[model samples]
Target: MELQTLYNEYLNIKFKRGLPPVRTKPFEYGLYADDSAGLFLTDHPEETFTNWMYELIPRDPHYISAPDWQPVLADVFQQMDIYDELVLYYLLFTLNTTLSVNSHNAYSTMNDFMKNYSFLQLSHLSEITRLNEEQKHQVRDFFFFYYLYAHPVNEETLYACSFDGQNLVHTKTDIPLERYFTAFHDHYSTNIKEYTEQIAIAPHDIQACKHLTLQLLQCIEGKLAKLNMPEEKGLEAVLRLINDVDQMLQLHDNNKPALFEMMKNFLKEARSTPYRDHCFTTLLQNYASYILFFRFDEIHALVEYFEDTPEWCRTIINKIFMDTIFMERILRQKRIDITTYPNVTQFFEDEAKRIYL
Candidate 1:
């Protein structure tokens, strides 16, 4: 069944009889008998003249033969939608599987149409559980094909999701219905590239060129919150995005310094701007991780920069302020000798007095 079908079924259960094979009198039909299990609805009973009809529905997608285990949502009305969504998802996967297998003869042609309807086409992904690796791959691909070719999703959704039948596109968002998130990432990459090129040509004009990248960054923050991504693909997209940043950091020529400098400037600017949200912090964290190990000397520079920022925002810099004891604890875990960097020693001492004293 498609999402629409599942949604309709959800509404029906929410409003009327929970599911079919319902009964005002459970005693009348002992148990439901059908290819599809006699799902029971749990809605309040409605009586005509003879028997009182009780709600009954499938306990789950599998349609267990018995109704004893069927859930009652009466107690948790506030969180009812969460339950409904989970159940609907189960219905979606099961029905998709059943229909696909049933249409084996017509599947080849229908599949082309089906693929255009599934989660593979968009950049934003949602979590789809209870599937093995192969099914996960196929479902993702199918959705991508479906989204791009069949139903047209919104621009944010279409572009935010990335889809490739071969790869599992690990993502981490909650709105993966008919979205892939690759499309958005591709556009982001394009913008980043443009910014890089422009920055190279006019290095001194960093302020102007940086806005192109900044705009992309700012857009995604609001856009992603308004938008979202998937589990498998979400992870992949973030890793790839960070990797892209890392790749840029590895640039041995002129662009490398400019990029780093711009990032440093961004960190400072974000502290005061509304754009100082997760997107900013996440990128900042990535840069900090790089600086932590490679540029131990410059670590103090960041510490000094974020001296007034929040503890959560300070991170490694914050750790430094907790006194040498904290650094010792961290060094103990990473097994890095504290003796290697003199700047770190002097820097920590100078600041330790200012902070601790």
Candidate 2:
């Protein structure tokens, strides 16, 4: 039955019973049903009234019916609204086999879109379980397609949610947050190709850019937090700052030395101004630490390369400190906090390898 027709019937039933009709437009009935689930959290009789109304509504096209899993899978593919196929595949495969064997269906399964609407579109679902090589390839493709078509949104609602049992009230919060984070990390990392493509194609995608900017700063901070300032973190911070600038400037790989020199001169000149006592040594340490966190061995090679150039360790260190300070200002202004934003956290895990490796 059409959602509108079902909604009209539902309205009539609610009117007859003296229950207030759920305020919803025709197209929004499904969302209303999902939203109303929260109301049923209490064991009041109103919860039963809600469950009855939900049953009357047509099933969501994306809802998985385990009885006929194959057809359901086909239906999901046939109507590609928001469900992440790759995630679904993994969920199904694991639920039907591995996790089922271990947990005996103790935990909740399925992509929980109701938590956040653009979640599936903007964030990568974490992979808590393991998969074979073939499965990895399939997931990679899924990520590529979704991200390629994904658009920026100013604000988003919950698209769907992971359910525990028949009645929405029975939504068992058995799945731990860590599992979700792991799953998100897997999804993001596997889709490296798509991540790079999205960056190049949607450089102006405001939401994605905002998320990425925060992620960059978070990465820098995370690396810096692990080291001592001026002693160990200085060069590490500098390298990362250089990387951030290179990414911003789109500088050619071979021209990085020139970029370093330019930044070095800029810092040297700034010393006579209001910045004479600036703790550049500490700043460079943080910058270098950030680079080492992501790029590892690459920083060693970069350090060696700079050592042989006319601008040796001291000059290169000075240059990177200036860039680090500039990048740090931008990060502070942006107010980046990856820990607060799960999507940004996922993006960091996915893009960290690309930035450094």
Candidate 3:
């Protein structure tokens, strides 16, 4: 098996060099640590095996695919001088990004590996591989998959391959907006209102609007349920988690007001949940997100009375400072007093000085 060959190759290298046995994982959450034991792992030890240990990564069932194994084994190539471009690329080409983000970043991880070594450290990829015509086509197609076919991909994403003479050089191609947004809902464009405004300049596509509605629906249906379990992760984590959810919920649908009201009602139940001091900061910021999107019915859902706090000055006010035009109108129409965060007024004053001064 390929895993056996890779493992054997590692053992041969270690045996030839007479390095100490690897110490491996007592605890490994994601990836391996290079200097976890110490510089002595990379730096040679005394003839006795006293102060030397390295982690034997890629052991047992921990690594199944290139996304799992390539990152863990990359240090092997870098630390030891066994360069295998074909081996690395073969593993990469076998994987797809639809599974997890680790698959998505395989190219960027390869880029980081390439960025470390200069042309001096590497063999001329052409001389090393010596591929026939058909094999060369395989490499070219891999480029298309790595860039265009990956998740969170956009015009900004770079096409990449490792074995060509170009090796690290890659290209970025422009893609149409609606086609892009429809394929990937909230990956590239977070603020749906921004794209909604752009429809005037390039009118025809309402896919961005449609996608935003879908994203909100999916988040509420699937993701929000996981976070609301205050018993699982505690209330501080809940507040922080929900605030993270706040950033992604921007959308353009006629039903947005109703949907936001539903979300506000969900968060409203948290008042009785156990919480620490700054849980209210996320609550206020969540309300600010609603106000920014012009969803105002449950603007006072968290509390009937609003009071000023220094933390409010730092977070909610500072966040909506640029969008004060929308937020101030929401507060004013809701009969919420201006004293809740005076910095909203001060933000405009600072802007006034920057513009007219």
Candidate 4:
């Protein structure tokens, strides 16, 4: 009733494909037959079963040559408790010493030999899925750590390790140009007003002020057509703007004063830059309108900010104008015509629902 003898018998029963005579005890024979079939088709059928034998059976240290057992060992080790600190230390030492001191061909030969056993090892692991929770956890942890050590530089392997640990993956992609601009405009127009109001009433609320600054940037982005800008330029502009705002927010103690000073310098520089006159003009109009509506007291503050430069501010204002005008043209071109409406509010409500919902 040795474990190896039992495994060999089970393997023979399963892989040989012919059942022995039906015994008087039909139920026992049926159960054995079922178990045999299960083992043969199990994940890593060869490795799992062989490892099970190795673990359960007491044998000479070199009873099974390393070459003969290396493949199954490597495969099973991944799913083993051999990652325990003590075990890991020993395993690392063994792997390093064996490969380093051995002949140059030793590593390749070992790898080639291991590759040939992959199918069996995989089958063996699959067969053990029916094991209890504790057993399964041990198997999974072993395999994970094993693969981690083996393929340390492989991105996919690293991803698998993190996935196993965190159970989540994140992906990022560029927003479509047209939709990006529209979304930016919508968000800016809605949120920037609220943000500007916060700045006027409670400027000390650093977080809110920071959020508002970000919303303004988002608004500016919405106004600018990303498609018109070179990809690198667009990316660079966004990154620089965002980073500046973020850094300003992080320096909360001096942020409000710093922000005001920065805005002043920006306006001054804008006014002096003839080449950027159009962009300045557009920004100025938006600022003027925004100032008049929400932060009238800050008008003088803004004027002071812009006093040093005339031409650069004019360019910025012109750019803002172009954006607004371009957007207006696009809207007019794409406007939905409604010849008849009983009530203006109801008409708008329906139109809004159609477009948004």
lDDT of 4 by residue, 185-210 (tens): 24334454454622222222222222
Candidate 3's error at 268, in angstroms? 19
TM-score of each: 0.24, 0.20, 0.23, 0.18
Q: Per-residue lDDT tens digits of candidate 3, residues 229-311?
A: 12223344334334344332332133444444443444455444213322433344334533333444333331222223333
Please tell me which model should have the higher TM-score, number 2 or number 3.
3
Q: Predict model 1's lDDT versus the native.
A: 0.32
C-alpha RMSD of each candidate structure in angstroms: 24.6, 22.4, 23.2, 33.3
- State residue 134's C-alpha deviation in candidate 1, in Å: 25
Could you give candidate 1's per-residue lDDT for residues 71-169 as a string of tens digits? 332232323333343343332232223112112234343333233223211222222223345544543443343433322233332343343332322
Off by over 4 Å in 3: 1-28, 31-153, 156-285, 296-311, 319-343, 347-357
Q: What lDDT tens digits, residue by residue, belong to model 2 across residues 1-357?
A: 132232233333322323344543211222133222221212232332122212212233445654233322243234422333333323222211110101112122111111111122112212212334443333333332222222211111112122222111101223322233233334434444556632222222222222322332222112111211121232343434332433313332455555455445445554432112223432343234333323333344445544544334545433443322222322343454324533222222333424322
Report lDDT (Cα) of residue 175, candidate 4: 20
lDDT of 1 at 229: 18
Candidate ordering by TM-score (highest first): 1, 3, 2, 4
Clashing pairs in 3: none
In Å, residue 96's CA in model 1 sits off its true spot by 24
lDDT of 3 at 88: 24
